[model samples]
Target: MSLLDADAHTAHIFTGAWTRSGGGDAPVVSPSTGTVLGRTGIADADDVREAAARADKARHAWAAASFEERAAVLRRAGDLLQAHEAEITDWLRRESGAAAGMAGFQVHVAAEECFEAAALASQPHGEVLRTAKPRLSFSRQVPVGVVGVIAPFNVPLILGIRSVAPALAVGNAVILKPDPRTAVCGGAVLAEVFHRAGVPEGVFQVLPGGVAAGEALVADPHVRVISFTGSTAAGRRVGEAAARHLKRAHLELGGNSPLVVLDDADVEAAASIGAWGSFLHQGQICMTTGRHLVHASLADAYVERLAAKAEALVVGSTEEDGAALGPVIDAGQRDKIHRLVTAGVDAGAELRAGGTFEGLYYRPTVLDRVTPTTPPFAEEVFGPVAPVVRFSTLDELVELAGSTEYGLSLGVITTNPMRGLEIADRIPSGIVHINDQTVDDEAVAPFGGVGHSGTGSRFGGTRANLEAFTETQWVTMRADPARYPF
Candidate 1:
């Protein structure tokens, strides 16, 4: 229940069926403490191939299962996850340095994804088509057979389940490759839940591994689709491989989202939204507010209030009770965030508050006088750092918000609802929030990004996943027609 011991590692989830292949065993250290928490077994090409083949085989029975049967399994998985909430809360923090609030929320979202997928198991079956002849014609949705889910260490539970739930609901087997950092607690948890919830042995596999295992899964012939959530560079590689194999790929890539504040908006409320959106999860989220564009008239007051709020946040390990902020995933990420913040200051931006790090725990940083060209503003400084830039006019803000290569999410704040809507409507982002911050995700809402952020593929909602994970086939029947021309 605590830290997911090496004895509880997910190696057996793969080796219980096939012998552990290449890449050998590796240790999973707590990102917050730098202490080894568990060990994970890596799968080789043969192992990945075997799992894919079995998944393909398993799909036939799972696909043939009635909607009610599939829904029952999913609902059971959700209930089981809820039962394991305490364990989840304990290990997720150590594995990935998630705060208590985040770890709890991640469990809630993962369980909810299972339930939502259960309810949508029977949707988008088939639609009747109009035919000239007195014959039946319709289009039906069919599963892609096998889904290769490659999830990141950040919020692995939510990311992995989001793909698995929908893929399984549509009657497809899933092969999950979780990041090595949180393998045991992240990937194994899903495997354990589904296996206990009635999914077949080979129907689901948890491979806690590195590049070799991931490459094997991607290159496997039986893998019909790939749902990848990670860095844009890595995602591009996955996209290329999927393209080479002509496999369907839905990518949830990087984001450099902006939170815009208008002159007439509430500065305190906007600052609170900004602090939470940027600092939550140490700003490791793809939908994190990377750029903060505020009107010049209120930028000073907003940054002043935001700095006080950031300073008050507690930064420590989850073990320390009441700690609001935890360490970053690793020292490397923390250093990179620090570098970005330093560069922004060198470029004439002002470091308003908390620009230091102790271990992996980087304090919430606030930067003002940032411009569209500033490194922290332009690049995805995915750490607990907020770059506040002043814009004189709405047109200026819109242009600054769109200056980045990424366009996953945008937030607009204004007293006038219509004014906020006007700005949100013009922003070049997949998700636009009129009064809310950018870090928002719902089980039923379609969630994704545009431009460099993603492949424009929505991951949630009834229509998005049902369409993404399935192939439509149009069938036509002619019983008594004789209309062929000679």
Candidate 2:
């Protein structure tokens, strides 16, 4: 289908019944052209409650199914996604305004996650333990109850799958609340694939709406776990609500990740990788390297090389080939980025290159001499902006990097393996890249953060995902009851 096709925006399936809560419909728009593609049904409090209850009802049956049976269903879902990759990619590009390459990348990640989840479900369950007495003890990982997954707009499809597949692999029913803007392409698509994979009705449901639906879902008693990815403020709200019910809350929140470039680093390589990591997805990623801390001696050269590389990036719609950058997800995010960039300039930070804002398009920005007091350096600038800070010594650089409350991810650029290892150890982030930027997230790595960035982790491998959704239960079998009489 062409990018302009209006039919592409319609949701394929919506299993949960809607209520008359008078919630207004939400319009899904294309960031590239700022045009409304279609409208999604918005669920109010009543609708959200009903969906949670439905998922709760389905949980026991799904959990009781054999592991092989569940695996078969997930594998079929993977096949379905592979079959419709092109259609899904087009919808993602239109709904999220991501470049074609980025849209494709998300689809690829989702497929991999589905396959991984299936393989994990087929693995052996429980382990045997030996006790001091003649008793056999073992522990098994069992799924928690219904999981509430609230996903973000940027890379919605990929992030949603990261939470949903794991919850399903562990035999837990899921209540997914995707970002209102990209629900059709992200949440709706996943629901369809899971259904095609033969997931029983109500086993997994998508609740599409705004904050009202999300709040209701998190507050529901049936939901035993909550996994969220979004702003810090919203994450706090979710965390607080989950706490009321004492639910297991896993949040991957906002980040102002740092990229440290030591004097021994390869300036050319660092500049190239840094530019890509910061500008990719227009820097909408939570793990995007928004702050750059470079050695004072190499600061000037690093800035020059980074500016040149940033200039080379192509900015346009995803439909156009070779477009390296795309528009921000929406106008609100664009305005936030612009305000931070403007604040940096006013705070005496030098604009090394591109600082123009036109509509949803913000030029790849590079600001130098940014301090902790500056908005760009301190805040989560979720746009294509990279601010550079200078440090005189390795100790000072490490201190500066760890100063932030966010510890999501950090990047270190140094050719010396020993120095890279030493720097990685000092950083507080959950995942640190050596001689690379923070955007290098792989499916096999433990992806999460420390401190305010998030709680708990996701996506190390199949076992990691399974663990995230399950709790350990110990079972002791005493063949001779009289032997242990006290």
Compared with the true structure, what per-residue lDDT tens digits does model 2 show for residues 188-261? 78877887688888889877778888888888898888889898889999989889888878888988899989
Clashing pairs in 2: none
- When summed lDDT is taken over every stretch of 10 residues in candidate 1, the lowest stretch is 10-19
Regions of candidate 1 where Cα sits further than 4 Å from its true position:
1-21, 480-486
TM-score versus the correct structure, for each prediction:
0.96, 0.94
Best by lDDT: 1
Report RMSD for candidate 1: 1.9
lDDT of each: 0.86, 0.82
Score residue 196 of candidate 2 by CA lDDT: 67
The residue pairs that clash in candidate 1, if any, are none
Per-residue accuracy of model 1 over 126-230 as CA lDDT, tens digit each: 899999878899999998899999999988999999999989988998999989888766787787788778887677788877888788888888998999999
Model 2 local distance difference test score: 0.82
- Model 2 misplacement above 4 A: 1-13, 16-24, 132-134, 480-486
